[model samples]
Target: MTDPDPFRVIFVCTGNICRSPMAEVVLRALAVQRGLASRVLSRSAGTGDWHLGERADERTLDCLTRRGYDGSAHRARQFSAASFAENDLIVALDRTHERILKAWARSDDDKGKVTLLRAFDPHASSMDVPDPYYAGPPMFDSVLAMIETATRGLFSQLEPAVRAPRTTLRALRRPDQEDLP
Candidate 1:
């Protein structure tokens, strides 16, 4: 069997303590459910280093856990030019983070790879995944709902690109009954 092509994705927020980490976990769960986990790699980072080396905010972990997602073993990290080169897609949690990524991008090609996480949501015109850290639990729930919807859309868009053409061709082949006899 041929090795599958891998697609890397990075989610970014201000501190990597809330929005981005949540997005990473939610998207990973969605990808696994859709059987794209092995074809895709997902991680999260902060636009700044404020929370580098620290776990996601307790509230974020609690919310994710309650929603049936594992939030363990996540440590905050900062976005870097290397990550831009490594990731096929760099998703920013808000406009500010998007702009920061664009500014840090090494080239036009890298800049083009950066996008707002909410871009997949037609209803979210601003393309910003609102920060729920300062809000109540309901806000976090809302963010998760948005992330789930967007992640599903993202997976659907990527499915065709990652599907193995050989598999499809094999499935389309039919046996000759006369030859079998």
Candidate 2:
């Protein structure tokens, strides 16, 4: 049977305005393209509260727009220990965020759920998705590209489990009725 609940994922960065939001929207767009939109849930947060309640950085939004993904609705929020109970996966944009998240984890399970976003990218030279906050548009684009590659890899790993269960239709027949030819 198909599960009714969606698989929740939350992306984290130093500030919710950059890398994490980019990853969040990229993953959402990918889920939709792969037909797993209903089963997969994507969200983002910051390791710190510096940008809480603020929208994603304009450059981040611009990068997403150029790539055909939407980031207009994203609002910055802080990642807390309580978030562990709400998300199945907690993706950190960099090693710093990962370390912070791991420290906040209350149990082994919570610690296991926290991981670097680039961990899924087999070709990744580094595990961290660089922060492009102070960089120019070109850097934002580069970071978005990195996030896209890693997010795609992550989605591939999740596809099998999150995919809707397939079922076949059977013709109903009475106990005494012969099967249809």
Candidate 3:
């Protein structure tokens, strides 16, 4: 049988050079680790266009590499009102981005899609994932750690839901069509 549609998720931050890209990479890696990569499409964008077309910060790349996640191909893009329709979830690195996204929403459903990344992290002490752009490498690593923790939590919650549509579709197939591709 054909595969089901992948669940689309986009991470948003101030400039797309630090936190959001890290969250994107972390979440993608987690989905792959859990064998849900085919059922989840992860991406990232900035709340502002200042860094559009630029790669993630060097520190962000280094931290991701040290942890075995790839951030090499990330290019900055801005989140727009149009983005609300493309992603199933709009994850914000901080409350500020969350507010911006929700305010840009055209409907209640679109507004509801916006959430803070740390909301998934049960042990998190803050809702915001701080930007490490001007900070040293150590701070970048620390931020990445926060992203990894929250992303793992997010992936765990999404796994079963990602698999549900395929399972239901297969069950609804006729007995005679079970062997059909």
Candidate 4:
């Protein structure tokens, strides 16, 4: 069986530079602050390779830094089958990434590993986190808010496994399931 502690999580989006990396850094910081750093591993990637080696967008970096989050060192990477094999959970930023990831699933279990990031948010206004790639700085800020909110909710759902490693992996619900933590 897979190790229950250090539950792995990868945030995925179309470009990796904006939404996914932001989620990754925020989740990592949140996990560290909440004392779940060692029990959770947060990371990110893009569905496409267009910006494979780029740093996050300048606006994203500015917003993170302004919020005192460390996202400066994030280097973009493309999501692959290996990413799925490595992480316990793969979180898609929006419906497009979700559909692409679902198409790339190698097994039922792998497909189950993939879920929408906002699915964890009890108060998410929409099923997808809107892409802020083309928007102004304000949009990035707004999306950052969404990312933080959803990360809190996601960690809440996963906290049981951190506290009691015996918590079954099956407790993590699919995006379609609405069970609250």
- Using lDDT, give the best candidate's number: 4
What tens digits encode model 3's per-residue C-alpha lDDT throughout 20-136?
999999888888888888998999999899999999988899899999988999999999888888888899999899888888999988976787888888889999998898889
What is the C-alpha lDDT profile of model 4 across 13-63, one tens digit per residue?
998999999999988997888887887889999988999889999999999
TM-score of decoy 3: 0.90
Best candidate per TM-score, number? 4
- Rank order (by lDDT, best first): 4, 3, 2, 1
Could you tell me every candidate's TM-score relative to the true structure?
A: 0.86, 0.88, 0.90, 0.91
Error of 1 at 54 (Å): 1.0
Query: Which residue window of length 10 is worst by lDDT in model 4?
Result: 166-175
Model 3: weakest 10-residue lDDT segment is 169-178
Per-residue lDDT, model 3, residue 180, is 45
**Each prediction's number of clashing residue pairs:** 0, 0, 0, 0
Which RMSD values do the candidates have, in order?
A: 9.3, 10.8, 7.9, 3.0
Instruction: Report the C-alpha displacement of residue 6, candidate 3, in angstroms.
Output: 0.6
Q: Model 3, stretches more than 4 Å misplaced?
A: 166-181
lDDT, candidates in the order shown: 0.79, 0.85, 0.85, 0.88
What range of 10 consecutive residues in model 2 has the weakest lDDT sum? Answer: 166-175
Q: Is candidate 3 or candidate 4 better by TM-score?
A: 4
Judged by whole-model lDDT over C-alpha atoms, candidate 1 comes out at 0.79
